[model samples]
Target: MKTFIYKKYSPRPNILHLYEHVVSIHIHEQLRKMGYYCYVDYAIKAQTHDQGLATITIEVYNSMLETEWSDLLLWNFEITDALIQIAYYQFLAEEGVLFTVKNANLKEELEVEHSNGWQTTKNIDTPKDISGKDDTALVASSKDIPLLSYDIVLNFQKKEVAKESYHDALLTLGHNIQVHLSNKKGYYRSEFSVIGNEIKLSFQVIELLSNTLGQSDSLIATGVIEELIESEALDVFIDAKKARQLNAISISTFVA
Candidate 1:
């Protein structure tokens, strides 16, 4: 199998660490839904207290079914997009920006950001003070401040690749992965390469203090093997093998 390595460095190591944890869980859950088995061999976080930087190493395993490579790449793109959305949402939530459901009519009233690229809109309407105790007071003040909402969009650009720049293509892929993963982790340095069939991904984050969050194993095994065994063809194969053994025994008894 071929292998690819993607690395990144983050200055704000703690946030980056949390982002990786969230992405790892999300990607595994997504792959499982598509009938693919993914395993994390290891995720190690090395932090330098004096330097305030943390390095993370993550190794993932897959069955390497060639037929699913395209799907894998597409999902990789989706994973990047999802991470960006989640990071933006978390940021807004942290800033006390209340986000509501997407309203079609709000686009007409407010300046909606274009969907073609990464954009964030804040305070679609007036922010309301909803922390009132009296129901009458709340109702009276509701008209003074309206509920607020926000929109975030990120788009991926398509590029043609020449045979000479295959390595560059891998680098771009690695960058995309790192950008989404780095939003919370903080930015530092990163690298990406596709070596044989195996893909190795790693990153480093700088933290103010020390942490032990990334040292634990967070892999969950899938039941693809059991599912395959329960298929109709496998049942037929098992039945046929049993019948063949019985027939051979009967022939030997007659010969005796």
Candidate 2:
């Protein structure tokens, strides 16, 4: 279990709301497609068990390649790597959608990985009104995966010989060029190879008891609160092996 936290100053003077949400991403699903297929059974999940704070947890059930070192040392790093990819590729620059990992386990887990690899601002002050939905899906190129190489193919062709409408013809095809077109007086056989990523995102709502709300105090906020109060939705980016940066949240307090 882990906790995540984000805060928003309310219209009420001296009153603020700390938002909470727990998200889970199926990291292996995308990693497997990237040929990152190594790991036993395990799980990654984020939680906001406490108000104003969130935590990321990675639990490995087993592994095939057990080295002399602690199994967690290597496996945890593997998970962190995926988490970083998820953060940069999908959630960078999302205004007001900032939070942090509120657990020591994640810190200890990071010792095996990178230090402070997953960090975000403490609060968000976006537009007075916003829109969003509670959906999570794959992002092409992860919308941010650094290009590895050519992922598109384009070509051009011209007709040769009077009968075939082509007086002269030449064709070339290689690793980059897949086809050559030679037809009509002139023609173009060009297209791009998109380096698509099937990385997907999902959302989860944190339901905190509202009866404890105080006038001059702050409490854990939920999507429902944001939607009802701000008329906007929020997408929080988090990192856990199963870390999920909840997708567009519902557009009202009931849904937020």
Candidate 3:
């Protein structure tokens, strides 16, 4: 398991509550993509003499076991990325909502650091004007929109299948099927020319995980197969490879 420590100092005490909520939601969303659920425990400490100064500490956890720092570093980086975006969005919102409070100047500073001594700090700034922008769209684009890519290979031992058959198989499976064919090595190749009609399909997982939360890689693969079956796409491919049937379908995911 990995741990991240977040500290914030807010001159306006009320902003701490809002900051806590934003950070918790953002962290939970990011961890959900990695098949882990998370919870936050936080506390606010009031300064003894200073009326408006308060310190907040938030602790975040997930289900991953302790592994090499190099492996865990990527996950930490993603969490950090989400924190930065959340801070920016919250700054914009606070600038609008907290403008009425007396001496309500929002001076917020956030510091997030991982266990490995990696740290980042952001000083929230008030936006000049957030008049007509959609907050939901801004947040969705920054965090919820998952841009993922993967390689899927469909193999069949059948001989002399048409090239167009490969195209039809993928189209029947899903929408916006991006197919890149090459005759060169170290690139995606189509068995349409080599043996039978085989296709190397590259596409996003969001389409496959549309019906389900993309918690695990296995879930994503199972969802794709289920969708294909429901659309009768798998049957079409099987009929095309009637001579020998499909040997295997392999998927390897790369999250970007």
Candidate 4:
């Protein structure tokens, strides 16, 4: 259904990529073995940028009616949507993955129901089902929302600035860094983390900010960098500048 779960913002594009592989390849494989077919892919078209606004989606190949499906998949009227995503939200909040979450909070009540493998708890004599990350359970969670959530929930809301300004700051970052971010694409984080309190906060020149964000997509990806610097989050990758070279716009799109 191309269900866009979140308009996530963050700085680590590469980390995000690895996460997608885990879900689409590692976790989804288990589901595939069970006979239920589904599709999972995040940051659909990154197009090489350091910062990005990636799009994450999960689609089920099943078009069967609810009556035809097991009670586990019959969640909130969705066949496979909730089944695949709930575990991920739990992971991010618990794992400290360094990103923020939004929207799904709109469906806040959608938190995990049974922690013990989603749990085998049942009493009223409804159709029996066990949910968790195990293969034996008929009602199991996809258990990959950190990737899905990471891909979809960039959490740009953490910025004190408005989203438009955040994007504008990124455009400036692109021009200065000499990289480009397609307006429709997701912005990713840098290769390093800024969470350590005493660590030398020098921005890791992962790609050598050749333009000085110069390291290709590393700087241009102003997606969802969870770290902050001097109250200006964009500085986490490269310093903010006017992006003044008029012709530079051809190489990288920016208004400053």
Candidate 5:
């Protein structure tokens, strides 16, 4: 079992109440229905409401992968995507109904094999402003294996701070993330690519997490605490692991 943490102090203290387990659980159930499995462990410190500090731990696993490890790292992109949406709701609740928040873009491309052995691709359209994006249903069809590509965009307002924090966090954590599907090696060859804002966001998140919380602390800081306890994404992963015996799908099919 792997653990993820994100610890950050919000400039606006008013949002403190929003970080509670209740809200996290609410979000978890919503995602669970969407096919995510979730579990949350948290503690509240301090006697006063405003002075209290909250720390949460999230553990995730995908039963489909047939491993004791959790896919939360991969699902991070998807759950963060949903968290951004929920944040909008919080934004609205704080503001009035007339106010609007700009949306982020989360473009995704998925590769699948048709029953006839032909490769098929699908593109999903989401809000122009989205935080994290990943392919959710890759192994659904027995005819085709699942090769997924994820893309995520940082909120323009949070770009500078976010980038710094993301990079710092990656350095502190002593961890590396490799999108193997895009690598041109071995049995898998892929046309998939990661550049521009998508790459930028990954770095930014790492830096932000590092600056706010040390390595492991940062993972807990990034609302990941909320994600683990309140995500159905884990449930889906568990189901997927049981359903598909295959390891990750091959990317070589798309090469020209």
Candidate 6:
């Protein structure tokens, strides 16, 4: 079982928060129909437009399956595409409001801007369970979609005590970031709230990697993993550009 929630805060004198409210409602409905359990519980701090805040709680309960959980995450990533479509024609939708599904690569971009370095790569392999079902097959059979790999890149501004420290930091950052992208929580302010801040990350998952990259899997999976202990077959990145280059495929194996 996973419990997800989001809190939105805006200074006084901003009516834009209302737009965030509407987007939240829109997401809630879509998530529920997708088969994962979801709902919204809000915490409002003020009555006026200028200084208001909203927080929504979304939770998912899973039993004995990791693939379903991962598929739920893929659904969350697609929600951004859904928002872009919704904000275009909704009566109350505001202009210049954009939201992006945050991913590991997004964090790498920010770290680069801030003089910190980071890298990311995606590896789509069939990790199997005792039952012998690969993640892709499992997700597809359940939701009629496929599953892919998602990994992160981390660069340091200053030499730290060890690479392990940076690795640990990236791991925590990954968990916190994945929550919002997956729509595990409510709307964070307009989509722009996500697209525009260091508080958020930038990453892209396309429906078709091959169509966009014009490269085959055999050609791209060069030098993907460096460690002997790592078992996620098909290293997706050989370096920075290599790691960031990936197609965001819809995953169905992750929903419970």
- Displacement of the residue 126 alpha carbon in candidate 2, Å: 26
Candidate 6 lDDT over residue span 30-51, tens digit each: 4434433221111112111222
Candidate 4 global CA lDDT score: 0.27
Output the better candidate (2/3) by TM-score. Answer: 3
Q: Which regions of candidate 1 deviate over 4 angstroms?
A: 39-67, 70-256
| Candidate 3 lDDT over residue span 111-163, tens digit each | 32222222222422233332323222222122243323444444444435555
**Model 2 vs. true fold: TM:** 0.20
Model 1, 248: alpha-carbon shift in Å? 33
In candidate 4 the C-alpha lDDT for residue 30 amounts to: 41
For candidate 1, lDDT tens digit of each residue in 1-256?
3233222233332233333433444444454445443222212232222122222232334334333433233124333444544443333323233333232332221111111112122212222322223222102211222212211111222223333333333333333333333343322223334452212334333221114213210110012223322322122223423212211000000000
Root-mean-square deviation of candidate 3: 18.0
Candidate 4 residue-wise lDDT, 22-76, digit = tens: 2323233343234332211111221112343323333333343212433232122
Q: What is the C-alpha RMSD of each candidate to the true structure, in Å?
A: 21.7, 24.4, 18.0, 18.7, 22.7, 21.8
Comparing 1 and 4 by lDDT, which wins? Answer: 1
TM-score of 3: 0.26
Global Cα lDDT for candidate 6: 0.27
**Per-model lDDT:** 0.29, 0.23, 0.33, 0.27, 0.26, 0.27
Model 1 CA lDDT for position 131 = 25
Residues 196-225 of candidate 2 have per-residue lDDT tens digits of: 111111122112212211211111112212
